[model samples]
Target: MENEQKTYRIDGFSCANCAKTFEKNVKNIKSVENAEVNFGASKITITGDATVQQIEKAGAFEKLKVVDKNQPKPEKQSFFKKHREVLISGLFMLLGFALIIINDGQNAITTGTFLISIIIGGYQMFWTGINNLSKLRFDMKTLMTIAVIGAALIGEWPEAAVVVVLFAVSESLERYSMEKARASIQSLMEIAPNTAVIKTPAGNKELPVEDVRIGDIMIIKPGDKLSMDGVIQSGSTNINQAAITGEALPAPKSAGDDVFAGTLNQSGYLEVEVTKNNEDTTLAKIIQLVEEAQQERAPAQHFVDQFAKYYTPAIMVAALLVAIIPPLLFGASWATWVYQGLAVLVVGCPCALVISTPIAIVSAIGNAANRGVLIKGGVYLETIGQSRTIAFDKTGTLTEGHPHVTDFMTYGDYDREAVLALSAALESKSEHPLAASILDFTESEDVEYSTIHIDDFKAETGKGITGTIDCKIYSIGKPENFDDADAYQSEGKTVMIIKENNTVIGLFAVIDPLRESSKAAIEKLHKMGSRTAMLTGDNEKTAGAIAGTLGIDTVYAGLMPEDKLDAIKNMQSDHKVTMVGDGINDAPALATADIGIAMGKGTDTALETADVALMGNDISQLPFTVNLSKRTLRIIKANITFSLVIKLIALLLVIPGWLTLWIAILSDIGATLIVALNGMRLLRVKE
Candidate 1:
């Protein structure tokens, strides 16, 4: 039988390099067919058979622990406990310094104390580095190990000890930053309750979410967070959906309304019928997608990885020449040149450069997820940031998606209420799409039409409906039957005529209204230097009206699916265009655009197809996502540039032979910390 693939949480990784090492080691296992480590998520996936003990042993160099991915996370250790080895090493180093001062020079006791400190603090680094060295792998660990061992062989005991302790501290700092970045996903995972109060056949019993099947009724009370994706079967409430949509306001929900797991029921009691299993819940899918997103390498990350692959070996060769050439050509002291070469090796660790892009990518994606923007990958994030044009699908994207009565006018001898009441009563019996709008309008006007009854109702396709009310004949139908229909159609409204005994009495003009946030969102996009366009299947007039109202730069009206795709392709000829749509109907255009953004309330197809999802279903999040993506791109460039510049400056110190082990290691540590902290700033980005 074939072994199934599984993913497990991993602990004890100190840096991205360690994660790489662990992943490589796991892949080397005899029974494991494949292995991948998600450094940002601190999780490992293995294909084929591998026992927990076997996987743990693969990471033994780092004392890595493997746990079930679904298990509750272990409580955090205190700083001292977490860094015990480094702390112990530091204590011994301090003792060595004390001894050196007492003796007024380097001696046996101080040397032994420093040696103990180095062994304690750098054993893992040395072990992994030496193992990698044997295999001709020159990762950061191998470079640091070679540098530290060289420093010791040259009798620089105190500096070597300090280097070891400082390196460990730097790795610790890297781990902490990764943890902080991962915390966004962790917080999301913790949002929904683990169990739910299930209404069972025997009695109401609280059960684990996984044990609750579809059709199970979940009882949620005020202040309770829903534990399943379900529909409200009974009662009503206001739900705070910040966990799912990042919307601050509490949404009102009544019977038959949908509710998602992780959302809080702010008021009222609800018996919700479960619609999805625990692992299939929207929250679960978000967590899964976010984790998968972290695993994808951005274009910048690919460049950095390739650069580092060549860069590390080049540094080694340069260091070799620096050590031998000066001594052979100019009769410089071998010890001095060799020491400088080792310093060069230490300076070229690539700690910061290796992490510059991924940390930033992780931070940005995690932050976006927290804000209810599900950016699918770093590539999408970068594309969105670089996009110059944003194209929107008109109906559900920019408009209310359904028609509403926008204008009502009455003619001679008929009062507005009397005409509305008769029309509403007649239309209520018709099953046309426009009928709902008429009934909705009547309700909004507070007209007593529901109590009015219609008799002898007859519908005509593409024409109108006729009925008798209060012993009088009433007719409502397409505006083509009325002479004054041109005025409404010219304004992009659907006109319906109401007549008494075949004489026009009133007219109802309907149109799908724009979303309240659409205009402001478009203006914000324009201010941010993005040009906007609209693509719709609606006629030229309707599409032009909406485009004009929103100040859009271009409009592609009467577009079929292929036409929308062609429009996107055409737009790409001039600029990078992002297609924003309801996801299903716009899939072709979305797939063709530079980036695809879908409204969260859209179908599952939308969620899976789009490069990004605005969970609030409001375009207001569009400008925010663009701002975030642009900011993330800027920060990534800054991080890579800063890391390279710092390395260049440190390497230049070789001109005067001013570079020392202390200065080289400190530069690496400083650059690593700066890059990490800078990447973390994405977490603070707000709308």
Candidate 2:
């Protein structure tokens, strides 16, 4: 039989080392085939037949609790309850200090109190560390355990007790920081209500969203939040889609309009037909993707992991040398040099360095998700921040996508309405991109063209269409066949001419207008030292006009899908390039670019293929995303530098025989706290 796969949310993980330890222990289980832990997200995946009890036992060193991925989270405990062991140990250590002051020296009572404190506070650490030491798995816990035991052997009972209590407190603080970073995804999961008022065949009934099936009708009243992704079946209303799109305005919606789960419906009742199940909703997918993204390691993170793999063992050897070298060869005191060596081991813990990159990535990704930007992983985030040029697909990306009839002019004996009606009559039978534009214009003018029947309709690819109305032959095609056609084409409009028996009657000028945010977005990118380029299948004249208006640095028009891909390749030779498109038509180029960004309203192919997604479908978010990525990179770099610098300073103290257990633990704790806090600043970034 094949191994079953299961994922669970894990609690009580304190540090990256502990997470690794838990993962290793689980993989050692007899029935387990493989196991992996996402420390940043505090979740684990296992492929085995191991029971929940078995998994929990594997993580018993940290007292970890495991629950099903879909289960409700357990309630939080009070501070005192959560830190009971640490608090009790601290009390005992304080009592031991008082007894020493009263007795004027170390006595049986003081020694016993300190011993009790060490056992209580360091129980888990010692258990895991001792096991690791036996296996020769040198992690932070192993190093700390060696240091504490050495301190006790040297008759430094008070210092050992202090080390245990301080280490426990530091671990708690690290755990709290991780939880704070993970809260962003947790908040997103709570956006939509679990139960919805679904209209059944018999009557309306409220049920869990999981029980709601596709095609079921949901009755949503004014001021109520939508519980599923669906199309409105009856009535009209304005929906605030801020939760999904991050747009401030409420979009007016009516029958036939699609609505997403977690949107607020304001004004008018609605009967919505569910289009997707609870797990398949757009909001749910966002949460899932964000959680998965946290597991991906950035380049800096990989480097740090590789560095730490050898760094700890190297520190262990160095400490061992410092402990014996001076006393054996240089005539130094064994007790003094050994004490310095133990302090070196404590200072060498890589807690801060191990967490530097992941915390920043998690916080920045979460903040971007909240602002309607989805960065697929840390690599893409880093690439986007470093990209010097961005290439955009013109249609649907920089424009409104659908063309509109901007100008209508009559020639010979035809009037504007007559020409529009005739064009609409013939276009109603055609399947061209511009067909809807003529039909819409005819309806707006009340031209009554739909009643006319077109006969023998013939469509000529890349040219025009021909048909008969009232037994009269009529044709609509490119205006280039007629005189004065250059006038409209010069202005970058697509001109379609109507003719009767080869004589031109009238013409319609259409253009796909630029998006309101396009020019401003392009300008913002330029200001940030990024070059902009436009790619389109449109004519050179039209593409140039649009590019000029937006101040884009380059334009590549009249290109096929393959041509766009080639263009991206060319741009990559000199600079890193990002391709932005609607995701479907631009798949080849999007895949070929250094980074691909898709519009949120684009097809499913775009959402899955692109490296990043602008969920608001607003180009303005592009600048904000770029800014956030750059800031996150800076923070990660700063954290790594600060952590190493602090560790280096603490190690140098051993040269003058000034290093002590108190200073070493304080340095480690201070570095961990500083890096965690600095990384968390990413969560405050806003658009």
Candidate 3:
């Protein structure tokens, strides 16, 4: 049998500690090689000989059900069916309290009613405690059951009933908090419709998204949400991609342009040729990646996990000493000390501390995805918050990547047409961005150009290209390859030198305009105290001029692809660097930097290689992303501090026997609710 890796969705998997317990138990199984439980996503991924039966068995103690990822989870039981026992137990507790108030502690009926509440509310905890105690597994259920039984043994029936009711309420609130955190991710799934209108052999027909095939033509009317990824075959319209890319303005789309599923078509009728099925759509990929990002552990989350592992056991020992030492050694009153110890047990649960980091991370990642920012994981999100320096590629990053021909002059006996005709023919053979500008210029000028069969075509990165255009070899490159080229360089233009038979023929000056938002974004980064630099293959004059216009702090010009990587690595020694680019040449530097941010409109290689992707290729979102990261970190720290301080204060009360059952449970459960709400603040952060 071959080893296989499978992922299963888990239902009823809210407790963070229970997730760890399930992972540990699954790893201990003989056939399993490794197991990882993602609590935020409620999933378990395992690689080895593991079976669904084995996975279910590991989670049986927590009532967690393991099922296939694609399988519809068993329908959630109705509220009445699921919480019937909880309702009955609460009624019993109410009756018990009323009886005590009516009888004034003298009637047998009061004691009996209180006993009934204890039996109804405390039975499940006691059962779970016995099973766990037999296996030597200590958990919250075990601690609670022990505390309740000890209080009942010392003749404090009312206090025991109070403990049972409060613990049940605490569990309910914890489940509610987890469900609220998961709601943001679930909202993403509801954005796209389940059906689409596709053109069939007979006519236009409505079909389920799963039945829609690649190459099928989809008709999208104005106000309809797109149901599949495809390229426009005809018509023009504006698309609202705010759901996917977070670009606030409606982007105009024309013939042959790509549109993503779940985006709204705002104007004109569009006929699209489908390129991807429902599962492979960009919207689907974003949802899947966002869910996984929430599961990835950050450093603070890991620390809390380690802390809980020891914290629970140490608190159990402390409660035991409080109960036994005062009664046996100091001759303290047994009932009073025992009740205080039971209160300590209620306050010691690690519920708030464990969930503090993950809830904040999940909220931040989901929010970023909605705005068209894709943050891969919590670690990368946190790293971007700490980055001290950011290096940017000049073309397509700081400036509009498209360039236009400014001035062209023939140096030899050749006229403008003869030189440009040969230049356009040679440039047509290449796919570089500059080649497109040359082709556009020739078409605009109506130069009668003829295609020539070029032999031995070659290219030099950061320089230019060469090919055979006529009987003589022709070369098109930078101004440095020719003599007396200082005029164009001094004008801050990228001058392409044309040479044939070792003689200079012509010089073409071109300039790519800077992006409108570059200066504002750079100024914002500066205000945030982050240094910025520009790395480019353009000559020093051109690169320096563009950098100066945008107020960039440093410029590294005349660089090859490898040279850009070296520049990033050199900067890494002094400060954490963020490389931003949108081309194949920018891939190395993007990967070499401490954090890589890629423009959304950049090449697919650059997008995949980058740590963070700006879907609209807008520089304005850069400062917003950095500010969001910083805010997420601050919120996480606040949650952790608040949880610890509340617990510290509750624990101090136990020293003077001042704590009561209600106050102790409130301390633990209240902190949990407050921290959860605090972490959710990141979801409302605006881009």
lDDT (tens digit, per residue) of candidate 2 on 1-687: 788888888988898888988999999999899999988778899998788899899999989999664677678889899999999999999999999999999988898999999999998899999999999999988998999999999999999999999998889889888888878867887889888999988899999998999999999999999999999999999999877777889999999998989889999999999999998888888887888888877888888989999999999998999999999999999999999999999999998998888889989988888877888888888889899999999877888779889888888777777778888989988887688898988898889886788888999755689998888889998765465666666676777889888888888888888889999999889888999999876566667777888899999976867889999999999889999998877898999999999988522454587999988888988999988888888999999999999999999999999999999999999999999999999899875
- What is candidate 1's local distance difference test score? 0.88
Task: Name the TM-score of candidate 3.
Answer: 0.91
How well is each residue in 1-687 modelled by candidate 1, as lDDT tens digits? 777889998887777878888999999999999999998888998998899999999999889998764677689789888889999999999999999999999998899999999999999899999999999988998998998999899899999999899999888888888888888888998899999999878999999887999999999989999999999999998998887787888899999999999999998999999999999988888888888898887899889988988999999998999899999999999999999999999999898988788889988999988888898888999999799999999877887778899899999988999899888888888886678999999989999887888888899754689998888888987654356766676677777888888788999988977899999999999998999999976556656776888899999976767889999999999789999988776888988999999988623565698989988887888999999889999999999999999999999999899999889999999999999999999999997
After superposing all C-alphas onto the true structure, candidate 2 shows an RMSD in angstroms of 3.2
Residue pairs in collision within model 3: 245-372, 246-371
| TM per candidate | 0.89, 0.91, 0.91
List CA RMSD, all candidates: 5.1, 3.2, 3.1
**For candidate 3, lDDT tens digit of each residue in 343-420?**
888888777887788888888887787777878788788888888888899888888988899888888588888888
- For each candidate in the order shown, give its overall lDDT on alpha carbons: 0.88, 0.88, 0.82
lDDT comparing candidate 3 with the true structure = 0.82
* lDDT score for residue 330 of model 1: 99
Q: Distance (Å) between predicted and true CA of 515, model 1? A: 1.6
